[model samples]
Every structure is written in C-alpha cells, then in structure tokens.
Target: MQNIQHPMFALSLIFSFILVTHAFLYFISSLFSNSNYWFYFLAQECILFISAFILPNGSPTVLIGLLPVLIAQSIIILKNKLKVILFFMLSYGLYCIAITINYGASELPIFIPIFFLILLIVIVYTISYNRQVSARERMEFYLQQLELAYQKVEELTLSNERQRMARDLHDTLAQGLAGLIMQLEAVNVHIKNGNISRSNEIIVSSMQQARETLKDARTVIDNLRTETLEYMDFHSAVLDEIKKFEEITGIDVEQEIKPIHSLSNLSMEYGIYIIRESLTNIMKHSQARKVKIKIEQKDGKIYMEVSDNGIGFSIKNIGKQTGKFGLLGLQERIRLVGGGLTIESMPGKGTKLFITVPI
Candidate 1:
C-alpha cells in the first residue's frame, strides 16, 4: 500500500507544482498588459516555490516557511476582510500538513507520504461536506411540502363539516318544523269551524315538535363547542342543520347523505355556512317550488350538490346584485376552507350549487 501511495503522491506533487508554476508565469506575462498587482503576485509565488524546494524536508520548522505564500495567495484571491480571513484559515490547513510531515523526521524521506495523505484528506472532506449540505437542503424542501399538504387537508375538512351542518338543518329539523307549522295552521282553521277537540290535539303535537326542534338546536351548539372549528363530526351536524333550513324555508328540501366520517371541523362549518347562504339566496332570488340537496363522500373527498327549480337569474348578474352577500359569502367561506363553490344557472332555469372539499 505504501509503495502504491508513494508513486501517486510523487505524481500529484509534480502536477500541483507544474500547475502553480504555470499559473504564476501566466500572471507575470499578463502583468505588462494588465496591472502591477499581477507582477507582485507572481513574484510572491516564485519566492514561495523556491523556498519550499530549498528547505530541508526533515527540518523541524513551524508554519513560518509556508505562511507568506498563503498570505500572498489570499491577497490575490480574497478582497473583503471576512473572505480574506476564511481563505487564510483554509490555506493554513496546508501549513499543518507540512508541519506534520516534518515532525520527527530524521530526513526528507517522509515528505512524499505526508503530501499524499493531506491531498486525500482534503478531497474526501470536500466531497463529504457537499453531499451533507445537499441532503439537508432536500430534507428541508420535503418538510415544507408536507406542511403545506397538512394545512390544505385541515382546511378542506373544516369546509366539509360546515356543508354537512347546513344540509342537516335544511333537510331534517327544518322539514320537521315546517310540518309542525302547517299542522298548526290547519288546526287554526279547524278551531274556526268549532272543531275544538281536533284543534287542541294539533296544538299539543306542534308543541311537542317545537320541543324536539329546540333539543336539536341545542345539540348543534353543544357539538360545536366541544369540538373546535377544526375537528367536528360533519355528517350528523350537517343533517341537523338541513332539517332546520327546511322548516324555515317552507320548501320541500330533500337530501341523500352518504356515510362518511372524519372531516375537520373548520371545513364542516364552512360547508354548512355555504349551504345556508345558498339556500338563503334561493329563497330571496329564486321562486323555485322544490329544492334538493345531495351529499356524497368518496375517494377521500366530500361533494355537495344543492339544486332548486326556482326562477334563476343571469349568472353574470348574480354577482352584480348589491344585496348578494349570500352568494359572495358562500364563495368566500368555501375558499377559506380550501373547498370550491360553483353555481350553474341561467335566466328562467333552476340554479345548482356544487361544492367539493378534500377529506
């Protein structure tokens, strides 16, 4: 191993010397056409090279012999004080190698081996440092991507939950309330015709339904409080909200909710708000006779569809209306939850709202 290393070391030293000499000569030649600095630099390099050759290889010398050479190189390569300091430090490493080579040497016999080892160490260190830096940068980049993905997931989850809540209010509690209201009105008519017993029974039933509605409302509030805006069960909550919507709208709002769970509460709330706003817009703008809401969860995502067979307005004009907060608010709410809200409508045609949230 020493034999192989020895020859390689000799060759490397020869090559390095040749390169440095050529560079110095090139600078000297260019000096006449360029600047005096080049001449000074070339002179320093020549003096260093001659001194290294003349110095006895086994001589116990400090870094004094090599220090001037390094300082000269630094003056040429580095301008700013900080950069000069760095280059000086880097160049000083070579002095340490020289010192180690000369340490305990009876003669110059060990110079070749020491030079070879130093070169090898430098090359290996440079490669290893570069690889480590590259790896760290890559890891940081992937970490950022992961954070972004998590944020998007959280937002989508919240929006879906909101949509679910709105649908529930519109479909379940809302419908039940509307029924109770109708029954009461009917009983009122009956009382006018002297059907006192029938009127009393109807009134009692309506009261019961009212109590149930109040309970459901309380449930909604309680669930919202227990779970933060990010981690709520959207499916059941949305169903309840849809029930309420039906009761208030006096419209037959049909729903088909699929069995899906584990959505962020923020997403759910945003979704519910979007649905409520859409329905409100329908009530105010569309004179449709029937409304339908469909919700589906599949492929790690939630989808909602609300359609009304009402007198639809121009899609362009919908945004232009001064009192169009329902439409604008729904859009903004969905966006915040990392979901999308799209409206499809034309004059005299029914309107359809499609909302999608990533699970």
Candidate 2:
C-alpha cells in the first residue's frame, strides 16, 4: 500500500545484518568458547534506536524487530524469569523513549498494537525456551549423578576384589607357608633326636598340603582375571539379562536381538548396564505381567527398546518421581558412551524405553 524509498530503510538494513551476523557468529563461537554477548546486545539496541530517526514513520519498524533479538540473546544467558521480564520491560522502555523523541506523544496510538504483539511473541518464546533449557539442565544433572554412581561402583568393585584377594592369600598361601615351616621345625627336632622315619613322614605330608594350596591360588587368580560376560557382545548380553529376568520374576519376556558384532567394549558394557537397570526397574516398580525387549544395529548405531505393560505415570512429573526411570541413572549410563535414551508412557499405559549408541 505504501512504498517510498527512505534513509531509514537503508540504515535498518545495516542494523539487521549486524544483529543476524553477530548472533550467528556468537552461536558458532559459543560451541568453541564463551563470548562477550553484552557488546552485541548494546550494539543492536544502539543501531535500532538510531534507525528510528533516519527512517520515516511509514518505514518498517526497525526498533520493534530488535525486541525478539534481545529476548533471544537473554535466553542464552539468563534463566531467572524476573530478570527476563525486567530486561524486556527495560528494552521496551528505551524503544518507547526513542519513538516518543522521534515521532511525538500523539503517535503512541499507532505503536500500541505492535508493542503488545511483540510482547506476546517474546513471552511465548521465552516460556518455551525456558522449558527446553530446564529439561536439558535436568538431563545434565542426571548424567552427573550417573557418572558419580559409576565411579563409586568401580571403586567399590576394586575394593571388594582387593579384600577378597587378601582373605584368600591368608587362607591359602600364607597358611601353607606357615604350616611348612612348622613341619620342617618338627622334622629338625626328630632328625636331631635320630628319628629318620618320623622326619620322612612329616616331609611327605607337607608336600601334599603345598600342592593343594597351589591349586587354590590358581583358581582364585583365574576368577580375578575374567568377568562373567567378557566374551559375549552387547546383543547376547541383553538376551542373557532378559532370560535371567524372566526366570526370576516369572514374567514372560519377548526379545528381538540383531547381533551387534562391531560394538566397542565400552559400548557393549554400557548397553548391558542399561538393560540390567531397566530390568531392575521393571522388577521393582512396574507391576507388569509381561515384558518386550528389542535390539538392533543400524546405520552405525545400536538401538534398543524395552517395554512393559505396567501402570505408568506422567513424563511431566519426572522431577517429582525421585526413583523413576527418567530421573534415574539410565540416561546417564547411555550418555557416557556417547548415546541417547528416550522413554514414552502414560497413566495405565505401558512404558517403553528407546536407546541409541554409536557402534
């Protein structure tokens, strides 16, 4: 309806480029390093304020366009709702001031609707972005907890092994050596007293005991060097877990495994752990009568799904469910091996777990 070339439109073009370019560069650089976004924010507001005077009233609203950019910038750094609202109000105030100075108080009526429209966009975007950020933060917190739990599990395993070794050594090698020494001392006493037959008998008895102790030591060493699932890969491991789970719980399990032969040891370990934990949760929390498990390898990734027909709960209330699936260590476990996990469920509905990991 209105098309007149103005200085303001040309000036606003520069403002748009700077704002978009800075945001792009900031996003990319942020992946490598933190940036001083404050400078970008100040520069944008300054440019938009300047454009209001050079451009005619009929030109595009350069000042109003800057509103969303400001909110986007704030979302990256600030989480406090009050702080976001304050920044929004402050920027809007400065914009209103610029308009008042450039166009006069009587022109306010023309800008009111656009101001409310921008506010709606900012509010909706802020709330949505805030929810996404909160979800990510919670996932991160769960990963940290999983890491800590893994460390504790490893430490406890090592400590337990050391204690077992110590106990075995005392019971086997140490006792054998002490008994040999006592028997030799007795033989010496008998030999000194000229009792050759008694000395020979004692020597033969000590030889037999030494052989038994050596056998016990070898058995312990073998156990220490091997794990229960050392040779089997991830796919077999999941089936094994399901087999055990069904046997113990009396709940029939349905499993589909596409053997993942190329999985790294780390990936397999994490996969088995996830299956184990999932089964544990099922046994403990889910009052389900049946379970289904699926595993497959596709496109250089391992995918797993475990579902059960149990009374389920809301994913929205995950934070409140202290010992539930999402809040627990499965996400963290899957995450450590450079993978992701997703769960779907609802009230009176079954829960399904989807797992993906690089092979």
Candidate 3:
C-alpha cells in the first residue's frame, strides 16, 4: 500500500508542477509586456529541474515536462534567434542530466536518439509555419498592387469618355451649325443678285440639313442615355445605316456583311458609328457615285472596309484641314476599343478605310 501510494503521489506532484508553472507563465505574459518575458520559461525549466532531482523515481516523468517546453518554443514567435536557441540547448542539457542521474548513463543511447527525433519534428513545424506566414504576406502585397492598377485604369477610362463626348459634339452640333452658316450666307448672296429660284433652292437644302443635324443630335443624346445597340443586332443596324445612306445621297452601295458570331457591345457600337461617319464623309466630300462596304469576322477579329471612288486627298494634309474631324474621331474610337485603322487614299484615286478590332 505504501509503495502504490508513493508512486501516485509522485505522479500528482509532476502534473501539479507542470500546470502551476504554465499558469504562472501565462499570467505574467498576459499582465506584463516585458521584453525579457522568455526568461520566465527558463525559470520554469529550473524549477522543474530542481523538482525532478528531489522527487523519487522522477526520471521518466522528466520527458513529460521537457516535451511541453520544446513544443511551446516551437509555436512561439521567435524574435531573438540566439536566445531561443540558448533556451532550447539549456532545456535539453538539463533533461539529459536528469535522465543520466536518475535512469543511469547506459540509457543515454536510447533516449538521446528519441530526443533528437522529437526536436527534428519541432523544427519542421516551425519552418512550415514561417513559410505560411510569408506566403500570406506575399498574397496581400499582390492584392494591393492589383487594386492600385484597377484605380489607374478606371481614371483613364473616364478621361477617354470625356474626350469621346467632345468629339461627338464637334462631329454633330458644331459642324452642323457651321454648315448652316455657310448655306445661309449663300442664300443671302443669291437673294441680293435677284435669283429668287436659286435662293429658294438654297433655303430648302439648308432646312433639310438642319433637320438632319437635329436628328443626329438626338441620336447622340439617346446614346448617352442607353447603349446604342440595346434593341438592334449588329447586322440589322448596319443594314439600316446603309439604307439611310442610299436614300440621303442617292449613291449606289455594294455591301457584303458576313455572319458575325461574337462581338462585344463596345465593338459593335463604335463600328456602327465609324460606318455612319464614313458614309457621311463620302456624301459631303467624296462626290463618288459608287460605294462599297464589307464587314466580316475572321481570325478572332472584326474587320470592316469602306471604299469609295471619290476625289481623295493626301492623308498627311488631311490632318491640317480643320474641318476634317471625321478621320480624327474615327481614330479615337478605334483606339478606345484597342483597335487599329488604316486609310488608303491619294489626290485622285479612291479612298478606302480599313478597321480592325479584337472580338
């Protein structure tokens, strides 16, 4: 009975020492922000060391205390590498000393290998934890960079939209007003020369142009309110524009529109506007009796060609002509959608516009 109770009493003392020392360490850490707080763990190690020597048959239980210290060291944030290593070595040395003293020196071969194995596992866990922390930090950094890039893109988009709006106004309202002024001046001259028939004809033409300009302005406003192709598909929209061009200019149109399987709304909207502007330029300046338009989707891109047998001018000098805003607007529209445009023309030969946009 005495022997059984003595072993049980030793077990109780071992567990009580572990629990009380850990609790005290927790309390000190929680209540104080001391830089030398890790010393408390060393002090707990010393207490366990002294207690092991005094307790009878305490050598086997010494491992129970040593394992908890090693595991705690592995999990903690290691600020001081040298101090942590020193603490580990001290704990190991004291464990070895206690084992040799209580369990005899011959057991060193068996327990030493086991201790190193446990230490290796602890080292592996520490390395894995550090790698996870580094990976999480890198992911956070990448997310921040992406957020900044998105903001830059959003700002650039708004600036482009403002420029597009200005171009639309120049193409529609400003040019319409300028044309009306020129026609009115011509009407004044004809009336002064007593050419009533010619004056009436000029007035009629000016009225028609005014009506068309007003319609174009309304179309611009409607575009601002909603998407231009919300109700119409690409094919029908292009056909409608071709029909309108024929009726307005009395020019014969040769058109070949292939089936477009996939196109973004942005591409379709800009493409239609480019076509309409091209036809307007033909009517006003080209003086061409025949026009050809071809639209197709090939090689992951939308291709459009507008050709006319018109009295074309030099592409270089076209930029100097203040009234020639059509080409500039076309280029701007193409650029906005990450597309390209090529103009082929000479002083007398026909003019051709080639537009390409990715699907």
Candidate 4:
C-alpha cells in the first residue's frame, strides 16, 4: 500500500475513518445485541495499529484524532479500570515509538499527547464509574417495587380467604342454627297443643339438621387447613345448584350455559356463590313457576343473566337490611373481582338480573 505522506490529507483520512467507525457502532447497536461489542473493540484495535503506520510525514499529530475511539472503548468495551489504563498506556506508547523512530527521542515533544491521554483517561474512568453506580441504583429501585407488589398481593389473598370463611359460616352454621331455633319453636307449639306425633317429627328433623351443620363446619375447617382445595368447574357447580333448587321448590329452570373458557378459581368461587344466592332469594320470596339462567363468555368478560317469572317486588324497596348474604352480599362479592350487577324488577312483573365479571 502507498503511504499518504501529506499532513492535512492524512488528518482528514483519519477523521473520516473515525466518523465511519462511529456510524458502524451506531448501526450495530441498532441491529444487534450488546454481546457483539467485541466486534467494535477488535475493529478499533486494528485502526489503532494502522494509525501508527499512517503517521503523516513522520508527524504524530494525526494520532489525536483517535481520542474518541479510545474514549468509547474505555466507557463501553472495557469493564475493568486497570485494563482501560493499561490499554490506553500501550496505545500511546506505540504512537511514541512511531514518532521516535523518525524524529529521535530527544527531538520529540512527548508531553503533548501524554497530557491529553492522561486527561482523557481520567474523564473516561469517571464517566464509566458513574454509569455503574447509576445502574446499581436503578436495579435496587426495581427490586423494592417488586417486593412491595408481592406484599400487596399477599394481603389481598388473605382478605379474600377471610371473606370466603365468613360466607361459608353464614351459609351453613349460622343459617342452620336459625332454622333449628324456628323448628324448636314449632315443636313447643305442638307440645302445648298436645300434638305429640308432630313434636316428635320436628325434634327428629332438628337433630338431623344439627348433624349436617356440624359436618359442614368440619369441612370448612379442613379446607382452611389444607389451603389446596381444587376449584370446581363453574358449569357443573351451577348445574348442581339448579338441580337442588328444582328438587326443593319444584320450579322449572331453563339453563343455557355456553362452552366457557376455564375461569380462575377465585372467579369461579364468587360466581357460584352469586348464583346460589340468587336462587335462594327466588325460592324464598318470588312465587315464580319458571326461571331462566343464561351464562356465557364474551368480550373478555363472563356474563350471567338470571330471570324469574314470579311475583317480583319493587327494586326500590331493596336495602342493606335485605337479610343475611342478600343482594348486598352478592354485590360485594362481584365488586371484589371488578364486576357489575344490574337488577330489573317490578311488582307482579318478572325480575331479571344482569351480571358481568372480568376474566
């Protein structure tokens, strides 16, 4: 290769090469991942080698153009401070030898490049150190945020479990005790009227109810201890409720449940309770003969409609005092999982409930 001995031409060539190298570095960063930085380091090393041979007319001034390359490598390519220092020292030493061979060692002004090299090394090292510290701080901040999020999740889980326990107790133990009290009152009335056979029947039924209540309480405790209760499928669970309601009330139920995606256990639990609650209210209050229930998944939501052709009451009369685990409880359950409920009812007209829950 022919050496370009002109001073200005060589300086321009060196700078042009520097600018192109920077463009390649930017292009590579855009196209590839950080792991390929070694490519840039090797390229810089090759350019540094060629710069020595291209010392224009035996002048070392052209080597100044390489400061940006050295700065970039120090900041990005080298991870260790000692290695950066050693590499910069060796590169400057090579430049020194190139000039010394042309102008004897005594004639060269050694302090100029040496001065800039020291200054740049200090600046590059400081910048690298700051970046490392900044990165560590950012990592710690993210870790703290993650820990707080985990704690919030734990608290929410505990709250939901507490609510589940309360609902179970209200449905089984509390309601069972209330029923026993009413039955005992009936037994007292029968005994006072000298109806011995009727009193005996009431006593027997109350005993059976007490046993069932005890069994349910034990099951609740067992579930709490296990904490591994598998979720029942929503379709099957709702069907079981419908069957039980039909057997007890002899009300005709029409069900249309689409093939739904499997929902989360939490959603399934809440949904089943909502359905059961709605059915219980119907049997106790609505003197209806036919009921329709439609459940489907649409638009990233679970939609449930329960309509009864019964003597419906006014929605305005519904209040917080609508018995234990009434509409209020049902609404609370839906709200816990970011859901909405709409009730349409009128005296002597049919009642319809439109419920929606996010999946």
Candidate 5:
C-alpha cells in the first residue's frame, strides 16, 4: 500500500510541475510583440530558469521577477490551453519579426546582465549548501562523543562494583575461612600427639567454627544479591552485623543510632560496612569485654564510632600484622566515598575507630 501511495504522490507532483510550466509559457506569449513588456518577460524567464539551475530552491528575488511572466500567460490562456497555444505561436512570430526589423542592424548587449545574475546565484547557493552540510556533520560528531562518554561512565560504574565485592570478600568471608582452617589444623596436630580427649574437643570446636564461617559467607553473598543498598534498612542492617558479632565472639554489644530522614543509600551502606569491618577486626584481635557502637548525623554528615574496652595495639603497627587487610579495606571503602576513618589506641588501653562520611 505504501509503495502504491508513493507512486501516486510522485505522479501528482509531476502533473503540478507540467501545469506550472505550461502557464509560464502562455504568460510569456501574452506580453507585447513589439513593446518593452515582451523584452521584460523574456528577461524574467531567463532569470527563473537560471535560478532553477543554480539555486535548485527558488529565491524570493527570482520569484518576484517571474510574477509578470505568470500574469501574461494567464491573460493569454483565459483558462483554456488550445486557444492560448494558437495565440502564443502568433505572438512569437510577430515578436521575432519586430526584433529583426528594429535591432537587426546591431548586436544587442542584453545577455551581459543575465550572465552575471546567473553567476551570483550559483556562488551564493553553493556556499549556503556547503555551510548547512558542515553544520549537520558537526552536530553528529558531538552526539557521537556524548554517547561514548556515557558508555565510559557505565563501564567505570561496573568496575567499581566489582572492586567493592572483592574487598568485601577479602575482609569478611575470606578471613573467616582462614581462621576456621587454622583451627582444623590445630585439631589435626593434637590428634597426632596421641591426646584423644583433647583431639575430640578440638575437632568439635573446629566443626562449629566451620559451620559459622560457612553461614557468614552465605550472608555476604546474599547481601551482595541486592543491587541497590537501599534494599536494606540502615539500622536493621547494622543490628544484624552486631548480632553476628555477638554470636561469634560472646562480646556484649551496645548500639546507639540516630534516625536520618533523607539519608542516601550509597552513604548509608558504605558507612555501615565500614563500622562492621572495624568491629570484626576488634572481635578477632582485641580481647575486649564490651563494645560500644554509635552512629549520629551532624551538619549534613554521618559520624560513626566503634570502640572496644580490650587490649589495644598501636595504630602505627597496623602494617606490621599479617591479618591487617580488614583495616586497610575499611580505609579504602571510606576513601572511595569521600569519607575518613581514624584509629586511636595504646598497647593496654582500648581501641577507638571514628568514621565520618558526607551524605
């Protein structure tokens, strides 16, 4: 159907063009045979034809000049083509006869003006078309650049997510498995020493540790399944971590968190993870009796403090310990989100970690 309609439209356009051409020819014939009107009509027709060849799209100046030709044709035709054609032929023969009788003795200079007009039309049309084409090409180039920039942003986002997952695994599940493995190895050595009862107890403890390690690993994976951090409530997620910490270490835990109405998930999740990892390090290394966790908002920023009343180590000695990735990962996470983490402790005094993240 579209193909048929397209041909019909093309035919209509062709018919319109033929009608216009016929009208122009008849109007030219109606002008005077020996007067200035005949010369004027011929001159205007020359301009229109040159414009069509040069501009391709007719100019307003050219159309204005062509108007007299159109009017003369209309007067001769009287809306009937047969009569108009007979009168047109008679008028043309008379015009040629008058020209031969009046100006046959000399060469006319009329063609000079027509030649310059045509040249001007061609130059202006070529410049305008080239400029329009260049403008369109420039617009397309900018659009392609914008598309590439958006793609790069998407790729960087995916890369950051993968790095976060790796850091989480290294800090939580990987460390848990290492501890469990060490306990199992100790049990095996005890069995080789011929201490049957102690070996049995060590075996039982190692099994329990393995079970806990597997459960923690599963929790990490489950949490990762949620693409957006907003899927979990900040307070509830923090409490879950506290519960896990208490279950694993038998430490008394206390938490005080202030409500934030319009907290962004990115800031909240990162803050919670930082606090969780800090507490995990404390539980595994510090022989503390009680732990206090506090979260508060002030001046458009979230501040968290996790401190334990345990045998503390020097902050300067962090890199010296082999099991210090947890602290390093916490630092990296805080840095990723434009936040800061600070650790303060002495050899016998307790350790205190203060983290501040802007929302």
Candidate 6:
C-alpha cells in the first residue's frame, strides 16, 4: 500500500493501466469484431512484467485487479485450452514470486493462498460455462435444420401422391368418359336420322366401354406406380426429342433458340408439351420436308414458334378431326399458365404457331 502511494508506483500504475486497457480492448475487438489479438496480448504480457518488477514492495492491490483481467483476457482470446491454462498459471506464479520477494515469505498472509484458490475456481467455472453455452447453441441450430429437412420431405411425398392420382384419372376415367360422350353424341345424330338399329348399337358399345374403363382403372391402381420420366435439363430433353423425331420421320429439323438454362420447371414442362404436340401434328397432317423450331425470351416473357413448310389445312375444320384433343389441350395448358397461343395456316401453305408465356 505504501508503494502504491509513491510517485514511481503512480507512474507504473499509469503505464500498466494504459497497456491493460489497450490489450483488453484489442482482445474484445477480436471476440466481437473478428480482429487480431495475439500481438496485443504478447506485447501486454511483456510490459506487464516490467510493471510487476517496478513495484518491488508488496502491492497486492495491483495483483488483485491485474490477475482477474489476465484470466478474463485469456478466456476471451485464447483458442487452445492448454495455452489458456498455462497463461493463467504463469501469470499467477510471477505475481506470487514478486509478492514473496517484496515481502518476506514468512510475513505473507495466510488468506493470500485462499484468495488465489478462489480465483482459480472462478476461472475454471468460467471456462466450463462457456463450453456448455456453445454446445447448447450448436444443438439448437442442428435441430432447426433437421425440422426444415423433414418439412421438405413431407412436401415432396404429398406432391408425388397428387401426381399419381392425376395420372390414374387421366389414363382410365378420362378416356372412358370421352368415349362415352362421343358414343352418346353419335346416338343422337343417328336417332334424328331415323336409324334406330345404329343408335342401339352405339348404346351397346358405350356399355362395353364403361366395363373396360373399370378394369383399366383397377389395373392402374393395383400396379406399382413410378414417375412418368426421370428429371433432365429442359434444353437437353428438348434436343433429345428433336433428334428422335428426325430419326423417325426423315424430316430435317432446324432449331433456333437462346440458352434456356434459366427456365422454371413449370415453363419447361409446358415447353415439352408444345414441342411434342406441334411435331406430332406436322408428322400427321403436314407433308413437310423441313420444320423450324424457335424459342427465346423477350419483353420479360417466353416466346416459342413451331413452323413447317408443308401443305397446311383450314384451321376452321381442326375441330372435326377426332384427334384434335392434343392441340386443344396444348392451347389450354399454355393459356392456364398466363400464356397465349396463336395458329397461322391456310390451304397449300405452311403452318406456324406463335406463343407468349410469362416467366
């Protein structure tokens, strides 16, 4: 206490306070702001020795404050447990040695050892608390991620179920309903023409169709269902389809499209339908030698056109064709997704489809 009152001890206190403040702040900077702290700690430790030796007379006041600050600093900045332990031990040893030399070892207070033991307890408790907090936070984060992954898997399962139901309905019930309606329609036409025998025949055929529809529906439900197709990139799938068409029909296809890697899954699905429908129609009705396909994005929308150089038919009679379902369905799908489809054709000319769909 007398040494602390001396002018030289006051100077030593100022230097030690400034150095500790800087090191502690830099150590804080490293923890909260991700900065370098080891250099500051090293420099502070060297200066700390200087300050400790300057107070040759026992100054328990400085050691009491400085020891705790060193422990706190080591805890905040040091990553290695061994280094933290060694730093505390070495600092405490130096403090005891300085105090013992200044005050005769025989005159040291009995409670001084007890005071040091309490500090060691606090340091140990602090390290244990820090590790527990870190482990708990990590466990919470892992649980959150697991919950998210479970939700995604559940969503995928529901989506798959819906797709399967849709395919079953479309393949069996839908086709049966279409045949029954067409039969009923034909029966009406025949009854008006006073042909009773033909009308009865259509009614009998309609009943047969209903039975077949039931069997098909059961077959689809009983069998193990799988995905319609494996997932593939839209552009690559389109290219494969075109190549297959060329191989089958001997018709050369001229494709002109920009990079389509950014198209959404829904957009790509519709694109596939449009391509297949347009190409099938060309193969069926158009006696064309060459066909052109183009796709691009413009005005924040997707534009697609399929054209063929062949003898085109009258658009008005398209409805009369029994297989006009494909083209009509294509148009409906495109329109439902905020898109428009236009057909251009005339007798002895080419047919072209202009389409616009939002992104």
The global C-alpha lDDT for each of the candidates, from Candidate 1 onward, is 0.65, 0.73, 0.77, 0.74, 0.65, 0.72
Instruction: Report residue 237 deviation for candidate 1 (angstroms).
Output: 1.7
Predicted candidate 6 versus true structure: per-residue lDDT over 57-165, tens digit per residue: 4355556655666676678667678877887777766666667776767645753675477677777877888889889999999999998887677457546755776
Indicate the worst ten consecutive residues by lDDT in candidate 4.
222-231
Decreasing lDDT order of the candidates? 3, 4, 2, 6, 5, 1
Best by TM-score: 2
The residue-by-residue lDDT of candidate 2 on 76-175, one tens digit each, is 5665668667777767777778778878878778886787788678768877887898999999999999989976875576457557866786788788
User: Residue-pair clashes per candidate, as listed?
Assistant: 45, 1, 0, 0, 3, 0
RMSD of 2: 15.5
Residue 236 lDDT, candidate 5, scale 0-100 = 73
Whole-model alpha-carbon lDDT for candidate 5: 0.65
Which residue pairs in model 3 clash with each other? none
Tell me the TM-score of model 5: 0.44
After superposition, which runs of candidate 5 have C-alpha atoms over 4 Å from their true positions? Answer: 1-216, 222-228
Model 4, 1-359: lDDT tens digits are 22434346665687568657755765665454467655555566566556556543434544555544565455555667776676667666766666666566874576455647765776777687779988999999999999888767855775678678868967888889999999999999999999999999999999999999998986576445313324446777788779989998998799999866757666766777788889988988888999999999999899999999889877777774547327887888899999999999988998999999887
lDDT preference between candidates 4 and 6, better one: 4
TM-score of each: 0.39, 0.54, 0.46, 0.53, 0.44, 0.43
Quote the positional error of residue 250 for candidate 6 in Å: 1.6
Segments of candidate 1 deviating more than 4 angstroms: 1-232
Q: For candidate 1, give the lDDT of residue 162.
A: 52
lDDT of 5 by residue, 170-235 (tens): 777778778777877887888888878987887788788778777766656644633545577777
Candidate 5: give the clashing pairs.
26-73, 27-72, 27-73
Global lDDT for candidate 3?
Answer: 0.77
Clashing residue pairs in candidate 2 are: 8-55
Give the clash count for model 2.
1
By TM-score, how accurate is candidate 1?
0.39
